[model samples]
Target: MRIPESFFVIYQPKYTVPCVFDLNERGTFPNHPSVTGTWGFRVLADTDLKASVQFAHLVHRPGKDPQTGKAYEWMVEETSIDLDDQLTLDSAAVEKKITDSEIRSALMDAFNEWHDNFVPMKKKKVDIEELKQKLGNVVDECKERIRKELVRKNQHWVSSNIPRRIHDFKYGLYNHVKERLYQEYQSNGGEDSEPNLLKKIALFNRVLDNFDHEDLMKPDGTVWRNEDEIWQCWIGFAGSEDEAYRICRTMDAVFKDLELDEVG
Candidate 1:
């Protein structure tokens, strides 16, 4: 006969654990002799980290008791696995996989829809006539300045014996416009984001005036990583106090149900 204590037995429990592991934190895990070389240390194979954790669980598993007929049951926690099965993955590779993958992009799209529903972007009306007038004035000013600069340069170069340069470095142009453009950017609000029409024009002009012709060809794309972000999970069974409690409860219920079946 099943003991009455079976009724108090627990079966399963839910827990929230941080699934994200920063590659920088890889040093926290002990060095395994099986893995060799400096290259291995660069990226954290979440698999290895997880294996160690499971190894700990294995080490702590209960031994058989002389008095007891059955060994203590281990309640394994439910877990999810990471997307990649690679033996080793660096941060750059991981980011590329996540950011470049069509599937992951879909995830972002779905998330974007959810986020939009949660908080929609506000639409604001603009005074078209006023905006046009301001733009016209800005264009007129820019053109006038450029013409004067060009005329002065031509006169200066003609009088000098030095050869005319192929490249026109717009240092003076940028220097003159940067302060006004920055002010416009500030007045447009949103600080780093949401530049107004004038601000956008001014910024583009400033970059054009200041940056070398070759500068635009330089790469600007960069990946932003969040350490707390769960890159992936290694799904497995692990035991917790709550899981033990739940397992006890389920054991009790199962005993009662099965016992009733036998009695009938």
Candidate 2:
């Protein structure tokens, strides 16, 4: 058979293992001298960095083991076979077919030799339960630190920019009023103060009737002068853990609804 071009697993255990072989783009297995020069076949395994024996490439086959009466898959050493025509031969013409038992024994022998040499130095498998508890503690600590830092940063930003924002807002409001006053002054013959004033009042009243004041109202029922004020108010309101959780839940629900729509 022609050797596969992709990385193939020779053996795999029930748990995670480090991959040993790193394949370069030139199609050479640098880790194994036996298969270093051979091209076409690529093998990769996950093994401990300290140990030479790494196991990776999980292959799931159907059916239970006849001997153990439990479903199991073959885990063996990965080897690259040469793609040269000299290595390719018809088994029928050769008059000897390797049985499954023989193949298993050969692979097991190779695995055992490699394991014996390097397994003594390999670190013990990590206790997942203990690690999970430690992870939870770390996450809680991280959340608290992040919350505090965000609050400090936001307060600093608001303090530094509040004066500038207030000044800009005042200037904008003054300009709007000034433009209306100028328009009324010109339309009312420039010299008639009473007519200009009356016209300005009527124009402002019409503006109040047509404009949506609620557009400037924040969620907390306070009016905002500018977009920065609105953003600052929103950040302050939603900075709590509960608000974050609610937002996440809402986003998750929206995504799920979109997925269901796609499926339908």
Candidate 3:
């Protein structure tokens, strides 16, 4: 039988993040004229706790490099995976036989994944109400405490703090994406040879500065003129397989941070 979809959490995220500080050296982002970019994530499996990611690459567009006849550098490819019964069972002997470095790396990631994604044949049901009671909170106090953590569902972005709330969210999300990518890169046999992190950022910033187009300016009609007044954004179009893999990982991290499972 197909592994129950319930065993895997589902999410769809379309993010437009702009940070106050720049990760690239030339300082600001979204600076280029045709400044197109790409990024994506992959599925990492651990025994029974298998991971399958489905995400859109918000990076580059499809076209050929006019001179080289090569495809535009789309960061990652679209991908999916369905695990077999033996794989889901976390068979030790089978894992030993699987010597492909990428699969092994993914398995390591899955085994050490966050508690929410790990599944065997059952689940642990933590008792929240009992803990609330033990913490000296009566029903009314508990109600009030819960209310404080709730987000404004019907909030008007133009008239409320929703934009600011989203701003903070993307801030954390960006860091989550970058850090997860770096870790995955190092894990999957990426060697630090002639790597220049600052130079990459500087080149990215140049692309942003010269990006005189309307694509990156979408998500909201807000223009990125005043740096001090509003946060700066990091936008991408075409992404790669590793990028896709890490994208899912980063997104899961963001969602888990909300502790939404326990709250809403």
Highest TM-score against the true fold, candidate = 3
TM-score of each: 0.15, 0.19, 0.22
Per-residue lDDT of 97-190 in model 1, one digit per residue for the tens? 3433543444344433432332223244344455345434444443344334433433332223212111121243333344444444344331
| Candidate 1 regions with alpha-carbon error over 4 angstroms | 1-124, 157-264
What are the per-residue Cα lDDT tens digits for candidate 3 across 3-71? 222232222122233211112322222322122323222233322334444322222445565555665
Cα lDDT for residue 181, candidate 3: 44
Q: CA shift at 190, candidate 1, in angstroms?
A: 48
- Alpha carbon deviation, residue 172, candidate 1 (Å): 41
The number of the candidate with the highest lDDT is 2
| lDDT by residue for model 2 (78-169), tens | 43322111112233321232234544354445544533432223157444455345434444444455445544544443344445544553
Candidate 2 colliding pairs:
10-76, 11-75, 11-76, 18-46, 18-47, 19-45, 19-46, 19-47, 20-45, 47-54
Task: State the lDDT at 81 in candidate 3.
Answer: 42
